[model samples]
Target: MADAVTEFVLTPEQQDLRRAVRRFCAERLGEDTVRRLAESGTGHDPALWARLGGELGVLGLAVPEELGGAGGGLVDQAVVAEEFGAALVPGPVLGTVGLAVPALVALAGAGLDEDLLASLVEGARTAAFAVPDRGGRFDPALVTVTETGGALTGEVRHVVDGTADVLLVAARTGEEIGLFLTDGGERIPLSTLDRTRRQATVRFSATPARALAVGAGAEQAITAALRVGGALLAAEQVGGAQRMLDRTVAYAGTRLQFGRPIGSFQAVKHRCADMLVLVEHARSTAFHAAWALQDGTDDPDLAVAVAQATCSQAYQQVAQESVQLHGGIGFTWEHAAHLYLKRAVTDAALLGSAAEHRERIAQLVLDGASASGGVRVATG
Candidate 1:
């Protein structure tokens, strides 16, 4: 696995691109701007999304060059996600880049809505995809949306970026589940702990729908999109955790106690050291998952599960410690510390929770062990 990760190292050009994205976020996503956007009723700014999609080419990173995309893959997206995570820039990037684009790509055989794909690639239209309930579980039985007679009737809960111009829904069709497309639906914004990243409940009753691709491989395609989404989200968490730890350390150094810097104390030093471990682990796991997904390794599912579980916990813990380490200011709503903390918790629940991932890890390992004649491997 380490060798696989070594092979996936970012090239100089990729590193340069990452720094460019950092600059983009720094210039456009200033602290004041982020605050204003967060406080606003609408979490997304179409103008900002356009600039990122068209100028930065972030939305099209995974699309082919012929499709007006940057012609990159999951690794490139992980890099962009890391910067976005560091900045905590709020928008529909998750659904547009992670879910919508992947779904379109997977369904290319059915002549995926090229117009929709092109619009997304050019950042002309935003999109959202809803799957898995708030419990972070995707079960066909739980899918409330039903398609009948060329119309979709039912509601989708917790649709990521459901406020976009397009909404792709996963619905049960006979014995198999398939993807459905719609122009728009009734979007009910859900009040969340983290307002930076918006989520909404989409209600569709007898709404006209189009089937992009149905029948075989549909389930696998949905899983693939979700796994990659989780991987990119892990990258974001790593960035956030790094920022939180760095800020906490800096604050500890400057904050005086008993006529000396608080960081000089053994307890504070130990906490910082612990935080460093979490940040490093989160980064490594996220990168490993990205590489595994890109390469389509034999155990990509396990890799995603482990990465999601490890990174989510690391970020949440680091966030909690960041708040505690900063003492009083951390508790204030105005502090960026609380923002990261909220984002961490929200991310943890978005796709799945730490405990949920752990359950998956256990199931996958046990099944693999039984199939492999009872040899249990470490969580790798």
Candidate 2:
């Protein structure tokens, strides 16, 4: 069997992009700025969104040039996600880059690619995926669709970046399930916990929709796109967990109690050490998944499953420990610890929980590998 994980060596271009995004975040969205952004009632700053999507072209990095993008791949997007995670940058980075762009590129076959990709690349518009309703499951076939000619009627919940420009919604029509681009859905109110990432319910009662092609490879394409998202999200969780661990360590070193730094205490040291272990493992898992996605050489689903499983737990553990280490301030609204905790909790449940991913990993392992390297479920 292959090693539980493999190491990745980044190309010079990939390294450069990672450095650029890291520097940008440090300069433009540092700790103080992140704190203020989280507290701000505006939810997300439109100006920052414009700079990221339009000026930086971050939104279209993964799309192909023929479809109006810089032609960067999932690895590039994962790099950006790391920076966002580190700074806790408040925006639709995951929704737009991770979910929306990939889904659209996969669904908008042939002729539609040019126009749709051009809009996204140019930042003239944005897109979102309306799947994983209130319960937040990726079972696409379960989404209900009432199709009436050019109109689609249904309700999609937990629609990330739903407040954005265009929505690529999943719907079932007759015997086929596919994604459609719609702009006429009525928005339902939602009480969101993460201010940085908004969630909402979309009600489509005869909403006009432009059907996107799903071809014969639709399910595979959608699953591929989602696995990429899952892998990138794992990277984000790893980054976030590292941040939490670093912050807690720094605080422990300086926070004096009984004439010595709190970090000197055995209990605090053990907690921080445990955090390091989880974060390191999560990093390995995420990096493995990223490489698997880029090369398309392994079961992307299994890779993402392992990555997500480790990441969800890593983030939760790191966040909880960071708060506990910080003592009183961590629970206060003025501190940034809670923000990390909130984001970590919300992200843990994204795509699937750690438990769900573990089940998937088991299923993939039990199914074994086909002659062509793809995983296959043994039937009969």
Candidate 3:
């Protein structure tokens, strides 16, 4: 019998999707377009958003077909996310797809509002998961938003794309935590390090809300959503790191220093080689996490935690190296390197920092060891 193959490779359809998204982004979401949208009031292009949903059906990759979605999974979504990250595509893609879709899907059987999901699938609406903490840590105890008599009241800060048309808010009712759906809130946009992504403070003053899930169910949904977010975010970081690596290598080959291409120098060659290793490592971990989320093969939480820890740090290092490799040109606002660097730095803190994920990974490992009685100590 042949040895079982273990290498992870994208299916033909996935490759096709990647190629199409890359082409679309290159054509429509160039650096100039990204800068313009980042400075715009809305911080996203509505027309391009419509095209993504109506033409590419990217917005519904994780939605079930019965719900008017493509019935695809996280891997499919990761492909699109990677391309978006590479292009630094602006808008609420992360808010709607990465955060909202998973939460809604997890609560689909628990009085989930299908109408809202349908609107998101069609790109007619965008949603934000209004969770506490700017660092992407979703602690149920930190939920201060209170729901009373079908009304939500409290303030949620550091909400990604908080101005979204729909808000899937986590609120406390009595001793139980619940996921509430609301369309009423005062959105105040906040200045952030990553101009490509928007954050805002949402103040809900007795805003009418509908309960989606309460108690244990709501907690589970929230956890699942954040796990998916972290996994996809790892993929996004991999994309950004790969882009920087590519750009740095190309620049090194063409840049002249002392009348010879700088790439020929030992120092430049070593830096590029180190960048390649990091990109490859990040890509492997991120893709594995996506696969785990989709297929349930590995411990999904462990995979996600490892991916987040590895990819976040890798992306930040690569972006920083890319800027330095470009010398003075990369430091300028006119150059695209600064934008990627900002995104990398911001992403490191977006869904918790590298240190946070590493701690989670360690705890998970110890817990697993304890459960299986695998931990042992050596003594003299």
Candidate 4:
């Protein structure tokens, strides 16, 4: 059997990509800009998004070269995603890159929707995955939208980036689930915990849609997209947790109490140390999942479940701790601590809660055991 887990290190090219993304975020996605975008109606800046896709080619990192992408893998995409999370860059990145693009690529496989994919890669268009779930779970079995004669009708709630230019919807027909691509839907934006991310209720009224995949093929595409989303989300959580840790440590070292730095206190020191431990653990699990997805490990589902479960809890804990460590200032609206804290809480519930992923992990392990009559041991 193949190794269940392997050491994952960034290549020289990936390292350079990371540095470049960091520099871009530092210069463009400052606190003021993030706040501005969050408060805006669309919660996105098209020009900035264009720069990220056209200039950096980040949106297409995981797409194949023949499909007009950068011809990179999930790991490369995760690197960019991590930076986006750390900077709290507000946009449709999670929906477009993490969900829609993967589903489209899987269903099309360079055979269909080439124009749409190219437009997305160039930042000329954005798309959202309309899975009918309010709790961030993407179970193809739960899809309620129905497709008939090439038209789709149903309502999907709590859709991430639901206001995008395109919609990739999962619809059912006579017990067979399929993916359909549509251009317009009645969108009602919903207020959410994290203003940085957008959600909506989309109603499709016999909307003409192009079928991407049907029956088993559609299920496979949806599953592939969800797994990729879960893994990349874990990487994003790691980035957010790391940032919270960095900020907390810096504040603790400078903030004074009793004429000595707060960081000098044992309690504060211990808290920061704990945050560091969580951040590092989260980083390891997240990147490992990315590698598994990219390399097609024997059990990518298990790896994704582990990463999502670990990273979600770690990010929430670190963000909450960062706020507590900062005292009253952290609770204020003007401070950045609350923003990261909100993002952490929202993200914990985004791709699925830690508890949910743990349940998935349990099921996957049990299934694997049942299939082989015993658990397969890792050889390397």
1-380 per-residue lDDT for model 3 (tens digits)? 11114425788998999999999999999989999999998999988988898888998897889877899888899988888889998989778988998888888778677888888878888999898643355688889999999999999999988989989999999999999988899999999999889999999998999999999998888888888898888999999999999999999999999999999999999999999999999988888888878877677777888889999999999999999999999999889999999999988887788898878777667654775677422110
Q: Write one digit per residue (lDDT tens) for candidate 4, span 135-158.
A: 345566578899999998999988
lDDT of 2 by residue, 1-380 (tens): 23333335666887888788778778888767776775575456667767776677776777877778888877777777877787788766666677777766765554255676677667666667776632123565567865668788888777776776778777776677666778778876467677777777888988888767543444544565577778888999888898899899999999999999999999989989999999988987787777677666556777788889999999999999999999998999878888889999999888888988888777677656676777553110
lDDT for every model? 0.82, 0.75, 0.87, 0.86
Flag regions of model 2 displaced more than 4 Å: 1-7, 31-42, 108-111, 133-140, 214-217, 367-380
Alpha-carbon deviation at 190 in model 1, angstroms: 0.9
Greater lDDT among 3 and 4 belongs to: 3
The predictions' CA RMSDs to the true structure, in order, are 2.1, 4.0, 3.5, 2.2
Off-target runs (Cα >4 Å) in candidate 4 are: 1-6, 109-111, 133-138, 366-380
Q: Decide which is better by TM-score, 2 or 3.
A: 3
The runs of at least 3 residues in candidate 3 whose Cα sits more than 4 Å from the true structure, single-residue gaps closed, are: 1-7, 133-137, 371-380
Q: Clashing residue pairs in candidate 3, if any?
A: none
The top-ranked prediction according to lDDT is 3
By TM-score, rank the candidates, best first: 3, 4, 1, 2
